[model samples]
Target: MSIQDYPSRLSDPKSRKTETFSYLPSMTDEQIKAQVQYIINKGWNPAIEHSEPENAFSYYWYMWKLPMFGETNADTVLAEVQNCIKANPSNHVRLIGYDNFAQSQGANMLIKRGDM
Candidate 1:
């Protein structure tokens, strides 16, 4: 159920905070880097998105910045990630791969640099 349907006494048990990547099996730097490389190989740009509505129930996230595909280097991936994390510390952030030829693919929760 949406956050609105749930009661305020407690959080929803089925509440799925992150997508694509789980907090339990956090992704490693290498894995994330490889994924970024793959996206770059696919000629896609990296982007970040997040929600802004109050009550913390809105799932409609907006693009923090425009899709940047010029720099296909792996460093760009990490740079975008750092930028996203620095931009949205408290709010939820997602890593999206944008492409013009094909549909966009996004991997949620890619900012965890602690452990895999």
Candidate 2:
């Protein structure tokens, strides 16, 4: 089949990994909590976003209307994750941690619980 016929290959062995859980299985809530706590300890603020594009290569994304900063508690972070999940349950959702000191994202994680 031609590349245009298929948007993605589920079995691609060389899939690029850009974040902590990019390659392996998706993380549990506890794992996310611990990681977010770590980032908060470092004074980073977290943001959440979601999107449903025509293909995996699309660049379109929509940030949630809610604010992205000031919450450091793990439970709060996980709640936002759940909120993101609810908002875009069937598409791609991401949790990004921004370092105020560096003015750049330190953590970028995406999750999709079911087939696309």
Candidate 3:
């Protein structure tokens, strides 16, 4: 199919779309934890903040294995997330690697779980 007729792959709530990935791992454990806190502090679901210490490490790996979220600029966001996590240690949180899953899935989870 030509590019014009290739059809946009963007996901629609009415129609589930297949996710894509760039195979790039971003952020460290500290960074993931930090981002999780950031997300939680922003009024996201506390459950999303819940994760095992290992989750922090596997987060990047999960993102690497997932075929979705793009890698571009993800590191920057991860850094910001880490900063947030650092600022809120007592607030248990976990950063779900956006680069590892479909943005739609993330959004749906956030909404469904009332994390956002």
Candidate that scores best on TM-score: 2
- Decreasing lDDT order of the candidates: 2, 1, 3
Worst 10 residues of 3 by lDDT: 107-116
C-alpha lDDT values of all predictions: 0.59, 0.67, 0.34
lDDT (10s digit) by residue, model 2, range 1-116:
66443233546523434345665688776777777787788777877777663333456667766645777687877787787788667756777788888889887777553234
Q: Candidate 3: count the clashes.
A: 10
lDDT for each residue of candidate 1 in 4-28, tens digit (9 for 90 to 100): 4423232442344343354346567
Q: How well does candidate 1 score on lDDT at residue 66?
A: 77
lDDT of 3 at 4: 40
- In model 2, the number of clashes is 0
Full candidate order by TM-score, most accurate first: 2, 1, 3
Question: What's the count of clashing pairs in each model shown?
Answer: 0, 0, 10
Candidate 3 residue 66 Cα shift, in angstroms, is: 22
lDDT head-to-head 1 vs 2, winner: 2
Q: How do the residues 1-116 of candidate 3 rate in per-residue lDDT, one tens digit apiece? A: 65443343334322222222112233455654554555444443222233223232233221212222333344454454455455544332433433223333232111111111
Better of 1 and 3 by TM-score: 1
Give the TM-score of each candidate: 0.65, 0.72, 0.26
Better of 2 and 3 by TM-score: 2
